[model samples]
Target: MKKENIKKVVLAYSGGLDTSIIIPWLKENYNNCEVVAVSGDVGQGTELDGLEEKAKATGASKLYVLDLKKDFVENYIFPTLKFGAKYEDYLLGTSFARPCIAKALADIAIKEGADAICHGCTGKGNDQVRFELTLKALCPDMAIIAPWREWDIKSRDEEIDYAEAHHIPLKINRETNYSKDKNLWHLSHEGLDLESPANEPQYNHPGFLELGVSPEQAPDTPTYVTIHFEKGVPTAVDGKEMGAVELVEYLNKLGGENGIGLLDIVENRLVGMKSRGVYETPGGAILYKAINVLETITLDKESAHLKEQLAQKYADIVYNGQWFTPLREALDAFANSLAKTVTGDVKLKLYKGNMINAGVTSPFTLYDEQTASFGEDEDYNQADAAGFINLFGLSIKERAKLSKSWPKIED
Candidate 1:
């Protein structure tokens, strides 16, 4: 646990502003410990470009760029989708991603036999809890170092200054500074003008909107997309079968073009602070919408309703960094059982940020057209309604008779 004892440290590196400076800070504070940077490639695309060189240039002894795209989608994203977990209005993008990445970091640490695992999560953010809890769960004996809590760097400006002093190349400056976290599921923007709830997001600002145009700026024509699901996992887009990562990527283009998934919310962090964030989750929004429509047909009334109630609690568990707990696994088992019938196809119309369900179909649908029709059918007898109503209203009828027999009160 002591600084002198840490010979090598595995850091969760993103090649971002905070992490770029962290390499040097770790060396200075931890007696020049060998720093090994591990970057999780969760479909951030060009964000990971040149990351290895960048890490080495920043004084890291080595770098590992693990391709976690498929693992991230299949293991983390799909399970959460089955549970329909959303933390407030967040879609649990950044919330669930932390654990997935940390799990990878823990594995790499074990393989490298590193003395400590380091992260750039700040003291006041939910990511600190998420990353540390996962590390604690996966590798209980590993030493963990969080620089944001120990380092004296007070602000982003100080971090930038530290980067310059250490000759570490950075992609951010004070003026264009917006703290961003991007994964396959979503891209989250925070800080600067977003700190104030009243300031409208500057979507038009150069480099501000990476995914797509705003809803108002989208084309006038509507775009239609058909999604196929098998056992609650998205399998294809627009009649073309795709792998999990490819399907999400394909939908991201479509949804972004139509301005589909943009949200601004003020949410309660696990650290007990209210934080405002803007999220762009183009592909994920469409998938969630389509799957929910299919669930309506596939799931029975009680299972569907109970899943809705359980989703809130599941969201809390994920958001509060309890992903490895037994309760989460139990909930996943329930969700998976319900999802067995969730195979179907959903068609949707995307126009100006609106997702309108056009149609839904499933082989396991519970809807029976003949039984629900208004016309007389052999499945039901009209005379049965009278007896059924009488039995159903028996308590009400007894209460009424008792009320009449009671003496009237004086005015």
Candidate 2:
């Protein structure tokens, strides 16, 4: 975009140090462009506090905070859960949130007649692709600016210095500034000492991990809870039906207490790089496991196998910033179809990081106790197996008759 002609820009701002520093950077570089800050509330909870005042103090001309938590969990997160998509064991907390947040940025940019849409996603991360792809899909003509790619502040230390120089107030100092993302689905931690593969996570380090404790610190006794689902979406825990947001929040509390979900991995990013990170997805972990267990009895072998293969494709799409693509929409339709039989209750016993099945029941189960039992039943006869097995192995039998292995057996 031509800096001289641009009058205004819209920024995807979070009330964090990273984005806070960008507000001033845009004005200084873009010929004093007026920045309209937009933040989407996807259950970051207290993280959104004082965002308005912070945005204004940090040089944003105006701020628009949209309440997107309900839509976030219900639409984006639930579909991933239904498809059982996991990218290298990550629950995709930050991946899905980018589209929701970037959509808001695009809409606000268009509505405000802003010249460009800007974001603080780093040059090395997957989020830049996620944000830019959504912006291109929604508002292709709008000029897009990513501060990390353009700015000369080469490191977090330099960025902190810039923030302090501009008199920007921040919640983090240099030592504790882990690149983090938090939302309704989960929380993620990256950077700092976590950059090295050899370094074990300092789990007990003061404030290192949040949302849950380390598994070793979990209770000795297992915590049992029954998860109820209706058409693949988790509806309740222990017979208490709840709204989508409320249900996830409740499970977060229970799951966190038992150290339910904590993931660490080095994952391939869409930008052609691998980055190591830790994710805390307590409630999401419980739900993903619960739905898989519930589907075990309900789904037929062929359908279950087909869906299992498709789930990986769906996970790749979400991770690769293709959330707004037509292919993803088509996959979602199939996921919904497979999830029709996924209504049930899954009783799970959580001990440390382990999720053991206590019980599972569903109305549409394909398994029949009478037909499968060893005892005599009208649905099946023992003698029928001989003829069926003979027919099933006819090709093998014919081949064996023509083979030399028969001579060895006869001898």
Candidate 3:
């Protein structure tokens, strides 16, 4: 907590407006401590371009750019997907990536033997809690410094002015000042006109949309995609086998072309405030839908329904930054057990933001079409339903008889 205690600080740098200023701020506030900048690559693509030069130019002693895309999808995104975790209508694209990025930062900090870890998350945002909670869980001895909470600058305008005065090069300006977070899972947009719920999101705004086109701008024809899943994990797209990262990237391109994922919502933040955000999650949407189709065939009545209820708890845990908790691990264990039978292929049609199920097939399906058919079948007898109806409705019949015997009262 004291400035003199921090001899070296590893900062989570994104080369964004806030993080670009954090390097110099850490140097000034920590009594000119050595700053090591770390940028986690969770599929941000060109957003990370020029980050090494930028970090060094902004007063960082050294920089480490970690490629965490494969780890992110396999460990975080896929597990959450198996549990069907969705925070309201959100697919939890941004919520799940924070802990992953923070974990990478913590690992680098330990490797670099840094005394403290720093981030640019503001006090009002949920990311501060997510990043710090992860650090606390992983490396309790490491100190955390959040400059947005300690710094004198209050607003984006003030931060920009400070950046200008300090000669910190920034890619964002006033006109394109929407706060954004991007990873392999999704791209979230906030601030600027998005702060007002009444204003429709500028989906077509320059630099606002990187993943997909708007539904209105999508092609007139529908795009069909076939996905194969093994143990609830997506394995291939259109019969082409790929790794976790490769499959998601492939779907992102296909789904983006069809405008399959776009969400606008005013969600409750972990910081006890409601915030509006627009999100684009082209590939993630396809995965969620496809996996659900496989689940319908594999999971039976009781286990499937119970998992659905537990999924809400799972979503809450991930959204509230409780990824490292025991409950989450236990839940994942249960989900993994249930996913053993969820191996199949699902076909879907994507058209102008709508994902319609074409067909789903699995080896473990409970459906028996022959017995379920209306025509005569060797497996089922019509007389069996009469006995079943009598037994199943016995309690209801008794209740009705008792009600008939009771005296009627005037209202």
Model 3: lowest-lDDT 10 consecutive positions:
201-210
Candidate 3 local lDDT, residue 185: 86
Question: What overall lDDT, based on C-alpha atoms, would model 2 receive against the true structure?
Answer: 0.89
Query: How much is the lDDT of residue 28 in candidate 2?
Result: 90
TM-score of each: 0.96, 0.95, 0.96
lDDT of 1 by residue, 240-320 (tens): 999999998888889998888999999999889999999999999998899999998899999999999999999999998
Taking the tens digit of each residue's C-alpha lDDT, what string does model 2 give over 123-213? 9888899998998899999998888888888898998899889899888989888988888889888899899978998876658777888
- Position 292, candidate 3: lDDT: 89
User: Model-by-model lDDT, in order?
Assistant: 0.92, 0.89, 0.92
Residue 61, model 3: lDDT of 95
- Candidate 3 per-residue lDDT over residues 219-290, each given as its tens digit: 999999999999989999889999999999989988888888899999999888999999999999999999
Any runs in candidate 1 off by more than 4 Å, and if so which? Answer: 396-411
Model 2, residue 102: C-alpha shift (Å): 1.1
Worst 10 residues of 1 by lDDT: 204-213
Screening candidate 1 with a backbone cut-off below 3 angstroms (N, C-alpha, C), the clashing residue pairs are none
Decreasing TM-score order of the candidates: 3, 1, 2
- As a whole number from 0 to 100, the lDDT of residue 40 in candidate 3 is 90
